[model samples]
Target: MLTLSLILLPIIAGLITLAVKGETAKTVAVVSAFAELALGAYLYSSFVPDATSQFSVSYDWIHSAGIKFSVGVDGISLILVFLTTLMVPFIILSTFGNNYKNASTLFALILFMQAALVGVFTAKDAFLFYFFFEAALIPVYFIAAIWGGENRIKVTFKFFVYTIFGSLFMLLALVYLYLLTPGTHTADISALYQAARVLDVETQSYLFGAFFIAFAIKMPLFPFHTWQPDTYEEAPTAGTMLLSGIMLKMGVYGLIRFVLPIVPLGVDKWGFVAIILSVTGIVYGSIIAIQQKDMKRLIAYSSFAHVGLMSAGIFSRNIDGIQGALIQMLAHGINVVGLFFIVEIIQQRTQSRELSRLGGITQSTPNLTVYFIILMLGSVALPLTNGFVGEFLLLKGVYEYNVWIGAVAGLTIILGAVYMLRMVQKSMFGVTSGITEGFADLTFNEKIVLFPLSFLVIALGVAPNIFLKVTEPAVSQLLSIIK
Candidate 1:
């Protein structure tokens, strides 16, 4: 099936890359990633945009236990799959500027991570979903721990431990629901959904806690987010891309797929509490970002705030909220990768990311300055940029949920602009600092990554319905399920 090819091609290519030597592996990986992206685009074109799952592939994997190796894409899964396939080639190509040691192994890990991520997005069986969910952590763990900074070992470990702990709860929740299935027990997601929906409000509340803690930790919301800034600051740029750009989406996607439908009663009971955490995180992360000096760490905090808004929108439980969250997920992924890529180029060229040391880059590298400004505008949700449409709808969704909560959450718009504009002023304007005096303009490889991203920021903003249309039916289906 086309869906299977979408998930498996990178896996085979990654295995092939492991045997390659030198930069050849990186080349192979990049080409294969581009191929994967093309396949994903084809899948998107072919997808019907209906509520029903399409291009399904299923078979018995463990007959006695009623386990199955099943996967498919509905409109719900389609957009996330498109995001995964679309972002990865760029993620791979962005690394062409660096020649990491053991390049084969490094690139292979990325491809492996890609394969696992596709699996997470596509898996239709409960245990199958959990398998891919946890599988993604392994390659990223090595990517961070082995290739990261002086504190990489400890920080990556903490990140690994935190995520794994959360997943244990998900594993328990899935198995509990699996056992609850009527007749012969099974791990099919549809069956699990039905079984879960019929539970009493009290029981669903407990189940919600289990799934919510896991997804909340993955989204790394608020108090559960201590490990993120450190890990992002220390990991390789490519690894940071993986975490912020894609892996975090696993949590948001899980909330839409598993938590909301299976535990609607629980959502009705405690969705307000979830909204509180998300909104608090939005305000809390924005305020903290205002104080950070390191560019990557600041962006890390900014990423937290942006994700908080998306999370708030998702928990808002309206058509606008869910659709906005979906659209914002794609926009945020693109903008964050561009932001981090800019930071990586700066650090690579000047060996520093501190604002005090970074002024006036525009004096010498006006082109890069332009690129950074566009990406920053995208991050701040400037009108006609990709961020604007999503943020607008998200705010509308939350406001509809409760005017007071939406008003609190709306502070993100103002604070986001303040800190982001501060970053632009301190880093790009005025006289060139000593470190930036000899700054080179954007490289060909750098252009390879930023140009397309810049174009996407504008194009998607002008016509967001290209994404929204495919997702509307599915989101409507989800809303009906929640009822």
Candidate 2:
């Protein structure tokens, strides 16, 4: 019932929001989002920090097709569920500063997207997971395409085509796994895992390729990442938050949930190639970010770099690697959303996002500067901050996998500091530019959004155990399956 409510509440709220008009719709959306967050908090509190799936509910959906509506949360799912619920309100609140043309419709789509995201995180059936997986894209599509920048149509078209193309392969892979199940075939995840493990090495390798393509594109990793920077730049900030904060995790989670355990042999065979690509992306994204003058595009490339590390950590396939990925997913979502919000604030006040055109914002907007620096430090993985714990563990895991790759990947920290601090120096610290001469400080509404995110950046850093302890058991159980 708890699991089901988390999925249904946002959907119900979205419908109600659609019926309402004007400012009321956004108010309704925010209240409903908080309600959903409260429910998520309860679910987390009641949850046992162990390997078992909790709050499970299953019912027949398509018996002939061997599919059922199955949903639940283990520790792994809970962490993501926590991230989704925790971020939505801030994502919504961050938008309170701007008024869109069709405000009601925009808020409604965000709520709908949240529902699908919860569904994606909690699904216990393989087909259900894929269903939510693709379903999550629709509202965000409309959000980006409808309310985004002038080039939105062209950019979003490519974004839509790329993700849909990759998802087809995942659907094919899931269908193949479904047919291979034993008598009374089912798409139940546990059953699929059992069935997939028995396939010949070559067959599993093919499945691995199919699944990896789908997730990699969603993660928009390296070569597949061409769509991301443009999409993030063109999309509205809220849409960008959905893409960076919660949506990309769908891919990383897919790699952990579907790719790792189901096709261990294939991973053993081709995993090295995946690691190489991920590491390459880390360097490539950071370098590109360093050269970006546009604030949004710079952060877009920074996100690409951060996710590349998360992908590499997952492929490392150690407890430390996977755990780092898990915790880092949460940390990255918070930090990136904060960073994008800062960009939005700057653009809103100074009417500019280019670092060269802006300066000395900190001289006036001291509060904004502080929040930006905190989130920035977290991104660069400064010690005793959230990013540090995850990056340290990720480095440890990658090192265990191979010292050379780990050594190359370590450049993320140095490069991240370079690009991030440089961004701060140029945008917030130096002499006031003509455009930023009288930049305003953070609004009360803006503080409501940044303060909590800033708190999490430090909170998670100091005591990551709050998350690590919960995920450790489920991660151990997953590694056992792969072994």
Which candidate leads the pack in lDDT?
2
Q: TM-score of predicted model 2?
A: 0.99
Residues 259-372 of candidate 2: C-alpha lDDT, one tens digit per residue: 999999999999999999999999999999999999999999999999999999999999999999999999999999999999999999888899999988889887998899
Q: Give residue 450's error in model 1 in angstroms.
A: 0.4
Residue 221 of model 2: what lDDT? 90
lDDT of 2: 0.95
Worst 10 residues of 2 by lDDT: 192-201
| lDDT for residue 380 in candidate 2, whole number 0-100 | 98
Give the runs in model 2 whose Cα sits over 4 Å from its true position: none
Q: Write the per-residue lDDT of candidate 1 for residues 1-483, one digit (tens) a residue.
A: 998998889999999999999777887999999999999999999988789999999999998889998999988788889999989999888888887888788889999999899999999999999999998999999999988999999999999999999999989899899999988899999898899967999999989999999998898898899999999999999999999999999999999999899999999999999999999999999999999999999999998998889889999999999999999999999999999999999999999999999888888787788889998999899999999989999999999999999999999999999888998898888788889888888998899899999899999899999999999999999888788
Report, for every candidate in turn, its global Cα lDDT versus the true structure. 0.92, 0.95
Indicate the residue-level lDDT of 293 in model 2.
97
